[model samples]
Target chain A: MEPSDLAGMALIAVAGPEDALAFVSSGASSSAALEQEMNAVLNDSGVPRWPGLAAALLRWRPRLTDLAPERDLRVVERLGGQLLVPEDPEWPVALSELELNEPIALWVRGRALVIPEQKRCIALVGSRDSTSYGANVAMEMAATLVQRGFTIVSGGAYGIDAQAHRGAIGAATGRQFLPTLAIMAGGVDRFYPTGNEDLLRAVAENGAIVAEVPPGANPTRYRFLQRNRLIAALCEVTVVVEARWRSGALSTAHHADGLSRTVAAVPGSVYSANSAGCHRLLREGSAVCVTDAADVAELAGAPGTQLTPEQLGAPAVHDGLGVEDLMLLDALPLRSVTSVDKLTIVAGIGATAVLAGLGRLELLGLAERANSGWKRRC
Target chain B: MEPSDLAGMALIAVAGPEDALAFVSSGASSSAALEQEMNAVLNDSGVPRWPGLAAALLRWRPRLTDLAPERDLRVVERLGGQLLVPEDPEWPVALSELELNEPIALWVRGRALVIPEQKRCIALVGSRDSTSYGANVAMEMAATLVQRGFTIVSGGAYGIDAQAHRGAIGAATGRQFLPTLAIMAGGVDRFYPTGNEDLLRAVAENGAIVAEVPPGANPTRYRFLQRNRLIAALCEVTVVVEARWRSGALSTAHHADGLSRTVAAVPGSVYSANSAGCHRLLREGSAVCVTDAADVAELAGAPGTQLTPEQLGAPAVHDGLGVEDLMLLDALPLRSVTSVDKLTIVAGIGATAVLAGLGRLELLGLAERANSGWKRRC
Candidate 1:
């Protein structure tokens, strides 16, 4: 190898496989020329096979060094992290399908996981300035998502992002490994924001904290936006709670949409400016409106579709009423609300019988007072 | 006509025009039937149409000591002030379309009016126990609706109901006549809640207030449900802001739905127990989702297709920055925070150039900074 090639290889050794891909892609030099000029004469002679390889190689220049491949594995042994190249059987081809923002290489730590096994994974994203309403929704969605055996994925930021991770941890608090994954903008080793240092540590210890940047690399605004595509590519669904019209959480939603992942959002009061982003998503059909954990679970229908018999939580049906009460309730719905006298009029009974039936059903909670009349209750 | 004919006429009048048509088609008792036969036939008829003549004749019976058609008008005038019978073209046909709940005769005060005019009108109904969120929406919708020359229709009751009337009044607070209407359950003289007496009086003086019952009659629960159907029929649209799972507001929405009027509801926090009815309406597709007056107006579309240039208001489009900004704005969205540097990278422009353009756009009030990321503003 030339001295420069050797130096690039050493940098790859230190920067890891993924960093090498980014460096090469950034250089945009070499004109994607092969290590040798052998293909030049073949291409001049119009050899279709050589041109195809040449075009693909040059075309791959952008995504290639994102993972920064090393021609030799011996150098990879020096770094604690291992290289995941395109040729690796376990390397997710799904991510490569992300097109421009696709990772050229993945610098993974701990267990090298497979994407398909995490099919139920969901990305939770939202405003950095989340309100109590947004936070509650994020936490609820996260908790229920994890409870269903779905892995939760999110950026380890403050506001809705932090709550989402916390909710996932709360869901799997006592489990062996956290079913929650937190992606960071900076290097995996350096936790950014210091505020979430403890939370990120828990995430790293229990679940994986994946990043495309090299170790010790400080995350720039550029890198974080780049990292978001991975979150979108990895998850089956992405949910947003609260965001301003300019929140980055929306970018995650956009990434999810581009990746054909289900995007869900919690709706907020129209009066709240914080919920404007979520409303916009719903209006433009960018995200399905979600209410609770079950709602999110229903939309994604992730791997954790199963519900234990104990957790089946059924709603109470008002079937225990007497025949007379049932008749009254039935008559009441004949019109959505009925005055006692009208119930008598519609039921073809006396006022006495109608009043008695209503009194009984009200006791059973099968009906409620509506304005001056009565309406059947769920 | 035979004395027996008087009895049949009374029943037929009570049955109303639609029921009268049905009565005639079904070969039921004629208006000339004897009092006993009329009573038996009216009781047996399953149809809910009112026989107006019957109420008029019944009222005159005490003075006549015999059935007399001439005394009917006096009886009507005495029972509830002046009766605006259906025969009077000044009477709104909107009430007759409620089918079963249709009143035999309406007693109205203030300036007379006809519906399906050049004006757009909407009914706002919800719980008497409305949350602050619901009340605020009611106010905005009514004020905006009234200002747009759309008459506001609502029950003269408490909570959301009261707010609707108040908002309409506030919109044109000191105008010659506020563009607001109130439909009451009882006699016009007997304001049901009594607390809204002044508002109801203002509605009558400014726009309209109508009652289906006799002048001296008090409102029964039966009357309120019956009143809801009329409210639904009179307006072009009905909106339910906040309601319980089983609420009078839901009934009003259903009545509007049945009438084929545009029905909409403002959504609220799912965490709120009060918003359950609105959520239920959205889930069941009983109402279209609406957050503000413009949405309701746009969907309902100014009552008629031909709007003058002045009435059409602002076109939906904003200033310059056409398709590309819209596409990019749509592409990035607003949940996850996306850095400006990343946006330039994605859009394939130098960071400095993109920042300049974004700043210019921001000065134009089309972009907002959220967590240091830029996004298009609505």
Candidate 2:
């Protein structure tokens, strides 16, 4: 193509290297065509694009370069309807994987995403088969990290990992805005565990949900270990929440040390089997001793002054989620359904939002207009 | 003095080369008495001594020939205790305190006073506030070392140290007779931490209790750390049982490492505050890691082979300590007074043997005979 022909490309720009690669591979010269082709690729890849994606892409064009559009578009499509790339202004650079097995793209729908470039963004990792003792300790440390204004990063797995993310996200403090970054091994569509879907969704909506693998990709054991290295690399420190003697947590610690990052370990009872890996790390000199997130933040060279709850960050603040609203949402039929007063008694949302919310839901495509009043559609 | 008189005089030994100057100043002949007077002078000087003392007269001995001795018995007395003659079979020439703060003379005791020439002895040490886990581990390693026939050595404190002594003393194989030694900070007579008094007595009876300080000296905190170098010097391997962040155990470990002795440590729970010192040692590369006694024994180069109970050279195997005998021993009055009826009820021994045993006990100086009956002297 001539240099003059390359000038025909309109507004929105992409800066991500992966998006650049995807655009070049699609053989599209214009941003609009590139986006449509990217969406096609997502459909081909078995992921769905969001409804307002084209409009959102156009708004992001003035804010980002040509490559940013492709990457952000792919991210939203891959995450399904749960997450949307709300803006380019509040995104985490720490979640950006640099080349080697990078995150194909990031899918986030949080209130804020503020991962500072110069500051350390550590991810505390450990086994899903964590002991109760480990889980409690992970929670305490995550809370402490958030209180100290250190963004708590982790894999959003069950056990210790889940406790860590929950701690940072639930902390009343507002300093933990985009501080919590969850690097999942699987795709970003919905919660993988189903039990933790609400938790994962909370994290994505509050902080950020990140993945190196694209959406619809299932997390494999190998990917789990590979993702650990990312956890170590993105932050100045990596903490092992709890690990068995032969656990992937040890691998993450080793990766942190290899990257010249500080590796901290929480000690456990001498008899606790969950602490064996940490003991091994402590014995091997691969990890520093840490009792709380403050220790980690200190190791990361962050001063340990604690932030107030309001100062910590506003990640989990939902605009309108109440008990009645949830009860109504849960009452909806799993499959498409019909009937209004019958649904009202079961939903308990009353006549007010039920009428208004149904229209809003219909507009959102979550509910479709049907025979009687309306039918719920997933 | 005549030339023949000079020939008749034994070689005068000064505490050090500088010590002779005092002898000359005292107007004593440069004979053995001169050395005695000089030692008395030096002992009264209030100068402190350090461990690993080989000798103190560094090339200055020849400059003080004008010294003199006055009496012959004083000459023998001076040479007997103050000087260790190489011709004396009790001398262990292989024990060298090179480059370490050298001693004027080592106060020696025990069977043979034999130090292995060109062989190595390793020191194992750790916390007095040890967990049961650390003690058991220390014992196993001691037993293993005994099997390998390396001399097991340690401080005679409670916890790991006491266990080490017991393990070494209980060596069944007799592969290395008189296999254990305890180095004390205080005088060998005043064992600190009274709980270990019985164990110390057993150690004294089974092996040896050594101290660099003079007899009847109380142990100060400084002296405990001061004597650590001797532990390091006497052994080729040092095992740490368990220690808090700040304990005497780390001092011994550091000394052993400085002296180039092999240092090993038992790994403990990461969460335990007591094992923090051990963890720190492991972190600093001051000690190798060991899980069990076998691991430590292997590090100590101790031998272990299956030896039947019969093959074990137990001093004089007695059946499980009989309750009746213990009662008899316990029944002895505070003073030397006892009645036959009391003896019968106490011992439950037959009339013949009770008398015979009493007679034997009397002979052994453990009992005394009075016109009324018999009583325990001890």
Candidate 3:
């Protein structure tokens, strides 16, 4: 790596991710230039200092002397992964939407191209304590989406996330492109939630495991929440399969909605607490209703995709008869025939109109003439 | 009855209900004048001929000679009920929204005040083959709405309609106003669905049984479809509890939508065939999601009615912490103390930030100082 790239990585721990971007964008050349500016502001002797510079300098000065970029690079290389700065050719341009909050570098454990274009990717996420209905729906949706040539993205946690990945990997047959990607809250070197170790290992073999934090870092609660933003930004659509009234999946949905991406939620029984959050999203109008893979495919706008028309039950016997004919048909007896004069009073219509309407009904095979008068055809 | 009113009753069977309304609205004065106009139009057209006039005259002539308005009134009176024309003071003004399609007369078997003001009425209707989940939800919603001082209206059918009436009747303790109204497709003299005879009788005792047709009329299929409009028109809001893909309940929802009334549908499992129609309405954006009574009450806009705030689970321990403090808290060990120097690296922040954040965390009872270091509190 170049000296400037190394300096950017070292600055990540000193000034924090957001402020580090602010310092780099302020026309500094390298760590040497940044050090000189910090020294100048500390002595109160030289160039004008920006607001919050003093407080930031206090935080940066202590960490600045201890940053070891070379050792950080060596550790990742030893794990058979590589550090990817924004200048690298494989960096995702979609991260640019995050602007100043974007990660300084990515630690990748598998194929770099696993993160496909936004339109070709979707994130399926939900509660970690999901019911079997939610798990089945998530798995089915993921498998169908994979079969349609789209990659699935998730957090690599339990429940809906694990099911989504399993469905994608299970359906990936004879396909050259990877079927799934996992965005980790900690390091890609070792997956958190040790119960998912084997599943994530299989994930790395078939697709990719990525993280913003350095190797050996723990997945903290704050990092888990921040990780959700990456999953939201990496895909064109985010679907919440099932969530409780208050769940982490809702945060992911809100982030996707904030980015103006398509958000969808599956409907469940009103009696199920696990589906309350999904219904809340539907009620708030923040997410459209998504039932199956066809609904999701249409929302993703795949090439030549349209909503599959709803399957209708068999048509009723008198489906297309008009109002007057329907009334006449309703008045006709099934076992016996009655005179037209009596029918006029029973149906509450004119006799001439009843005769004409009966003729039309007979042509449609809905009415028949008996030996004496008219009766309904069964 | 007045001469003009009796003439209107006889005219109902000659022309269809809507055309009878049109003829009466055309300033014909009485049945005698209507006969003169029909005679004039039949023989080479003495007066201006309306479109469909000759056909209407042909139907009207045969029924005119046998008209028996007094016998029809006597039949209803013998059944301990009364016929209500549009000119009656007890007629609902809300039906005016139906305009020319309004019923010419209503056969009522209970209190005249059963069909309350539109603002105080709501319809809860669904499929005749509803699941237990839908039945329970309908019952609960109807009872709660009744307790909130609202009347429930529905088709006098089997499944959802029967349950709604039962719930409302069960909750109507010492209430002066009727709790429910049944709009039937047949004569009010006898309930159509024989299986629901006792339930329909109970509905009549507590509220009313109403229909457009006179005594001895069968509940024909066409009349059943048309009865949905009356339920839709009688209420300010229509809520579908559960329905199949092609259920007649959806027709009522569409009618309510056409009248610009509030429409709501309860959500259920996608696997359930009974909920498919409700989901279709929600997916098509024709109905809002309704889970409980508060949602329906808010939609009904009762006086001083507002939606109850959502019930939330217990707050998390780290809820109020900022991003930096949250990062520090995550970095702190649960079972052991760690120095600020170590935390600075683990949290990816400066030493000054780590020390200052720990002070704030300690004050909030989240961090504790132990043996010259800090650790997370239980």
Candidate 4:
């Protein structure tokens, strides 16, 4: 190993996050350079120590001597993963925007594909105990977004997160690089929540499994909170599908909000406890409510761009409709069947006009007669 | 009948809405005074006629000569209703805010009680073909608002409207003057949707049924749209519980928005067709999402004051909790059970702290362990 690599490994092993941050902010090019500055501060009687620096250096000196950088490198290589430093070509530059809170290095498992532009990367997160309604919404949104050439990023946990990864994988068309990415709290060598082992392995094979810690690190409570900031920093927009009040997903949303990234949340029934966090976010003006892939795309700065020619199958015959017919068509319910009387009320048109419009729509294959009355065709 | 009454009736019978508006805006206190101005307009050849006034006068001349005010009065009186001119003490002053569209007179059924101040009235409108979810939200919101000393106002149609009135009646405590008001599209004497006859009659007994036209008139498509303005004008806030795209309830919301009244909408599942209009309103920045009565009340300018001392039974023991405990309590799911592990994730705190907080909450009867996990108590 190079001397700089050995020094970087030692610093990561012994120094606290704030210590590493201070070292980098001082313009130290390498761990050895940072150590030299620390020694100068310690040796000079007149020079005052920076707040929290001297104490951290004194505390970490003994531990740095015990760390084995070569052995750690061997373990990472044996697990088919690699350590990524700031100099690595595959390093995500967006994390640099985090400044002081940025990770010193990243442990990555999977192909070292180039990180796409921020606009094409999105983070989807939510409650681990999400309802079926929430899970379905997350899956549909992920699949549709992936097909639109956007990469999906999420935590590889249960419920909404797991569904998001599965949806992206299912919708992969073999064209986009790294269709999904899972940022884990623990080491990339072992997936937490053993129940998601297969899913995480699939993700590692096709996309990436990433962590801030070295190999053999266990997922802890504090690490999860730290992991959320990385997800927020990596993407242009972060969407919360469903979260009860205080759900960890909200932490990701807040971090995204703090970073000035677009934060969108999927709204659910007001009565659903699982949606309480999302509603609170909407109520507090912290997040915009997004219903589908188009809404998400719009928030990500790509408005009016979700529906391409190939995805739409065939062009709709909307040009042929008159003003009244167009109003009636827009009034038609997408799901529930509606009657002529109700249609007249909804369209604010006369019964005769509504009936005539319905007839025209039916002939055009845009509407259909149901037992209840009429419905819009999918 | 008096001569003034005859002239007033004659003008209503023959003049177009614009002509009537022009006559009213001319500041003529009595029908006799308006007739003198009409004659002056006719005698002067050089003076240009106000836009549509000349054509309207020519069209109504013959009809005015044939109408009888006494017979119209008898028709209204025989139906156990009364006519309310602008001179009547029971007139709702808020309708004046509509300016050009304000009704010349209101035919009112049931008791001629004084119309409450605008701040005390609320309008709840939605699709006539409502889902069970929509109806439930409407009913709960209406009932809760009524219990908080606000009158519920809505169209007396089937689905959401009927449920609003029923909920208000069910929650009446006999403390407020009028518990509910039904703004009819047709004449006050004849209910438009016969299915709601009993409900409308009950509303007439406990509150009032108001209309712009005289007795024996049928509800027409144009009248329904016009009637929406009255509902919007009479209330301080208009809440759309559920509406499909282009539903008439949206007309009411638009009118309310135009009048600068607070427009709120209840959010539902994205998959629900009934909530599509509400969601659209939220997306377009036309309405705010409202979950409960307190939310509606807050937008109506009565923030944090929904529940009365008598209604609260006993104050919650929240003051004793520390900051972290309060956060955990707020994060607790109202309906769905949550586990301690999930709580820790949501609170972004240590698992040990969450476990300790849960134990304290259980002891205080604020939270309890459920089949799935922990949940807040009602």
The digit string of per-residue lDDT tens for model 3 on B166-283 reads 9998998888888899999887888769999998888888888888876767788777887888899999999999998899999999989988988999999888889989988988
Over the true interface residues, superposed, what is the Cα RMSD of model 1? 11.8
**Model 4 lDDT tens row, B201-238:** 89988888888866655575556777899999999999
Give candidate 2 regions above 4 Å deviation: A1-99, A114-118, A170-172, A267-273, A289-295, A303-378, B1-100, B108-112, B115-120, B144-150, B170-173, B177-179, B189-193, B260-271, B280-290, B293-378
Per-residue alpha-carbon lDDT of model 4 for A1-378, expressed as tens digits? 111122333344456545764563454343456566544544442334332333333323323433465776788788777888777777888887765456777888876535666888999999999899999999999999988888899999999999999998888867547879999887788977899999988888778888887776657555676789989989999999999866889999999998898898888887887887887788777888787888888888875655433323344456657755866787788899998876765554556667888999999999999896899997
Error in Å for residue A303 of model 1: 11
Model 2 quality (TM-score): 0.57
| Model 3 lDDT per residue over A1-378, tens place | 111122333455456656885664454434556555444433342324333444444444444445566777787777667888787778888887765456777888765434688888889999999899999999999999999998899999999999999999898887777789999988787877899999998888888888887776678888789788888888888999999888999999998997788898899988778898999999888888878877788888976665344546777887988766877888888888988898786665678778998899888887889887998887
Candidate 3 docking quality: incorrect, acceptable, medium or high:
acceptable
lDDT of 2 by residue, B1-378 (tens): 111111111112334334434533444433545445444434444323311111112111222242233342243234232224334565444334423233323443343245443244656688888888777767877776676666777889988899888887787344446567787776554657688888877766666666665444456444566678777776767877788776778888887787677787666654566676776676556777655455555565656633333323343211233333333445567575887555653343334445656665666566787787878775
Instruction: Give candidate 4's chain B TM-score.
Output: 0.69
Tens-digit lDDT string for candidate 2 (A284-363)? 66777665555577777876446434323344322244443434454567566756555554443335546666766666
Model 3: number of backbone collisions: 0
TM-score of each: 0.65, 0.57, 0.85, 0.71
Candidate 1 C-alpha lDDT tens digits along B208-278: 77676655455655467667887888888898878877677887888888878888877789787677777
* Native contacts, share recovered per candidate: 0.11, 0.08, 0.56, 0.15
Quality class of the docking in candidate 4, CAPRI style: incorrect
lDDT of each: 0.65, 0.59, 0.79, 0.75
Task: Please tell me how candidate 1 rates in CAPRI terms.
Answer: incorrect
What overall lDDT, based on C-alpha atoms, would model 4 receive against the true structure?
0.75
- Give the Å shift of residue A53 in candidate 1: 12
Docking class of 2: incorrect
